[model samples]
Target chain A: MREEKPGPLWLRLYALTVYLFLYTPIVVLVLFSFNDSRRNSSWEGFTTRWYVTLWHNELLMRALLNSLKVACLATFLSTVLGTMAALALSRYPFRGREAVGALAYLPMMVPEIVMGIALLTFFIKVGIQLSIVTVILAHVAFSVGYVTVTVRTRLAGMKGNLEEAAADLGATPWQTFWLVTFPRILPGIMSGALLAFTLSFDDFVITFFTAGIGATTLPLKIYSMLKFGVTPEVNAISTIMLGFTIGLLALWSRLESDPKSLGR
Target chain B: MKRFLAWALVLPFVLYNLTFVIFPLFTVLYQSMFTIDAEYNVSQQASLDNFKAAFSAANLEVMWRSARYALTTTAACLLLGYPLAYFIAVYGGRLRSQLLILVVLPFWTSYLIRTFAWTTLLQKEGVINAVLLKLHLISQPLQMLNTDFSVILGLTYGFLPFATLPIYVSLENQDRSLVEAAADLGATPVQAFWKVVFPLSLPGVISASLITFVPAMGDFVSAEILGSPETQMIGNLIQQQFLALFNWPMGSALSLVLMLLMVTSMALYMGLAGERDA
Candidate 1:
């Protein structure tokens, strides 16, 4: 029976209603970005004034730049570390290999708050002042886990003979990796990097605890702003952020559709 | 050559992970049980006082509220996600990827941005009320922001994709012939679905629930941004112990409790999913 059971109209209606409910808030944020007034709840005349204000907000721009910096650094480090870890674990068997794999996965499985506080305590105990550097270190810890998992799945499916052939042809292990294995698994690495970059950029809780003074990322900036009140300026910033995220997501999904294309 | 390179490649990765991830976790357990002061001094005696403080009436109330809120959010996501997953799987065709992207996009944005977006939409005289009032559907704006409703809405929206993707992956992989055979045997669409499709998709549903629910339980940002003081969750309490009150012991204890809850539930979820698959 290849036929789908037709759910009741009410069931479909309920689903549609839930979707509307889901999109409604996002739609409101995008719409109100043009509100002239400073307040979020009360709309005056529609204006681009808030967007203009957002454009002029130097502090927010700086925080955004800082976030970009940390995300890039974290992504780069984790991608290299994680891919190498995945390769080492997947390609060769060693004593305690499964145990090592479990350790690699631990960072991701633990709660953010626990990790955050743990990092906080570590930093304080070690007398390392909280800074942007700490945040990057903290992010890389978890980003490495995600990157390893993503890359491991790809490595597991990959045939090993290709690299063996390269080695039999007199290529060193490192040379074989760079010549054959690297190119084949590059897509997984790239996807992992993309995911790590996003996770680091958007991270709130871990960043909150690990980021000491002078390390205000955009999320932290917005969080601090919330303490005072919500404003149209925040809405304008959020709308732009949403657009950027969704646009990236569209591209990611498009790439994700073809499993072979991931190798690209 | 292979063995030498393997150890060379893996050593740094392994060592760093142990020093950072594994070590810190143990440190958290130790910190939770004992007190530390400004000079980084650890007390000689350990006590369960920290756990007691964390589970005190006031803090326990927040923990309970957090569980309630997380459960509600998980329920909402599953309910919304299943149909959407089905629609995309069976009906979406060419637009499937794009629709899936829509579900996942928000997760990339700064969580602050998404939660703030909710506040914008849910506040009194916000766009929702404006539209409703303009339509004359209501004379008064609905009270929305800083309420449980806004918190739940935000949590559900933010986590919906986590719920949908696993379910969609499984649904997409499902063999269509069984459903066809059921229909050929004169089974109604509902019967075919309940008897054929739903059972096969149970694993996806189980995993999706686990993915969304576990994280939602520990989520502090959504509650802080969307909920009022009264609606603050366990996450907020944990934050208080670390940031506000500077109580490391209490923070550690709370973190352990949160970890325990998540582990037990996740294990249960995986167990159930395994049974269903079998």
Candidate 2:
């Protein structure tokens, strides 16, 4: 690992070209966000009109709000349930534990289209009205898988000494958990929540099926716009979304780099 | 008290899974056996009629077409992704994380947005043809949109990152000393790569292919948005049946078959991968 043998220069250049090809479409999307033309053929003059249009569109605003609501709710609920599941699975020696773990992670592997259709069918049969609540519930069902994977790693890596020490010093289980265990794994929990939020926010297929009328999400709205054809407003939204995700990744990297911040 | 609390903590997940995931999946099989009407009433009669309809001559043709498209798209992803992933994993150090983030940022955005971006690039008056015309590369705009080629291109582009990351991880974890030793034993660089690198990274390739294949099999968005009727995949057909025709039974049957195909392929992939590892 310590050896720093430099490879051929052409090897590095070829790698850079590969990266460029992979990312050029997204770069083009971001650049075209500022194009003033209605058609996406040639870039005219730069303008912020599309951004303003996206901001002022009431339907888009509603969809954005719905997406935010579902993502936030799903993140919170999945984080709580997932962390508890992670803790239990990591600590307990129980029957059917592997099966439970497999069941928990199965949602991530199943195709979203199939899950969406299945849940939609289930909701119909069960007489549950499809709404934003249904969307949130569906999101939680999948988000928990991600949260479990993330939080379980942290919990598994965590030694039991701190919580045991707190209990040894006459702390209650609840107090020990809140003070000693929770703080140690908070970064993992937060990171998992952020990932859940982004996943739920960007989800389209499942949300498309489960969402009732008036429960449109940002993705559904963007999908509808695609059906109509490409618009500069779509580019603007993509650019903003791209910027937002990059910013979140940057912030997450910062938080992760601070080793002392995650004491566990 | 501790046992009770543990049970309480586990109950929510258990209940959610049973109600949502397991029940719904089994119900899909159940639903396919019954007759469902427009009024959402289900008849108790069991029959293979829906399966018959789904596997009818025409629909089977659609399934075959979808499979062919999925295979091509998966092949494209591997073709484009392997060399790129190999280059990045071997040569990229400081730039790897940044480049990876760039690859994944589109993933973080809506699938609709990325497909739409492709549309903007592929439409008749779109940037791609415009640039081609401007540069005099062709006398006329390429008739590229709404074809199998467009769907394949979109699916490949969308799934490239999914294929790249696993292979990259596997390659990054490869033992450098093994490669060095092989080279020192008079093996050429290409020989070392084929003997040492390819064999070690086969697991990632298998898993990557599975990940790419399953989703591409069920990916309705890319085909619906980017493809014409001739190129619509099984996903689009399933969606049309359930959403538009309100034919839950046939849709459920179709969905079941698709799921079975995915599971079977994935199982085979993992089986082969494990055998190779052993």
The TM-score leader among the candidates is 2
Q: For every model in order, what is the number of clashing pairs?
A: 8, 0
TM-score of 2: 0.95
- For model 1, residues A1-264, the per-residue Cα lDDT tens digits are 334544557665765776676677778777777877777777678899888876789999888888889999999988888888898889988777888789787887787878898888888877889999999989998888888888898789888998878978999877987878888888778778878887888888899999977789988887887788877777777777677666655555555555567553
lDDT of 2 by residue, B1-278 (tens): 65566667777877888888889888888889987777878778899888878888888888888778778888887777777777767766677676666666666666667776777788888778988998999988998889999998888888888988888889989888898899999999999999999999987887789878888888888888888988888899889988898988889999988888888877886887788778
lDDT tens readout by residue for model 1, B1-278: 66776777677678778767777788889888897677757678998777777778988788788778888988988888998888777766677777676676656676677777777667786677888999999999999888888888778877887898999998999987788899999999899999999988988888888888888888888878888898887778888888997877778889999998888878887887788677
lDDT of 1 at B188: 94
Docking category of candidate 1: medium
Clashes of 2: 0
Query: What's the DockQ for every one of the candidates?
Result: 0.53, 0.60
Candidate 2 residue spans exceeding 4 A from truth: A1-10, A257-259, A262-264, B36-42, B271-278
Chain A TM-score for candidate 1 is 0.92
Cα lDDT, model 1, residue A243: 73
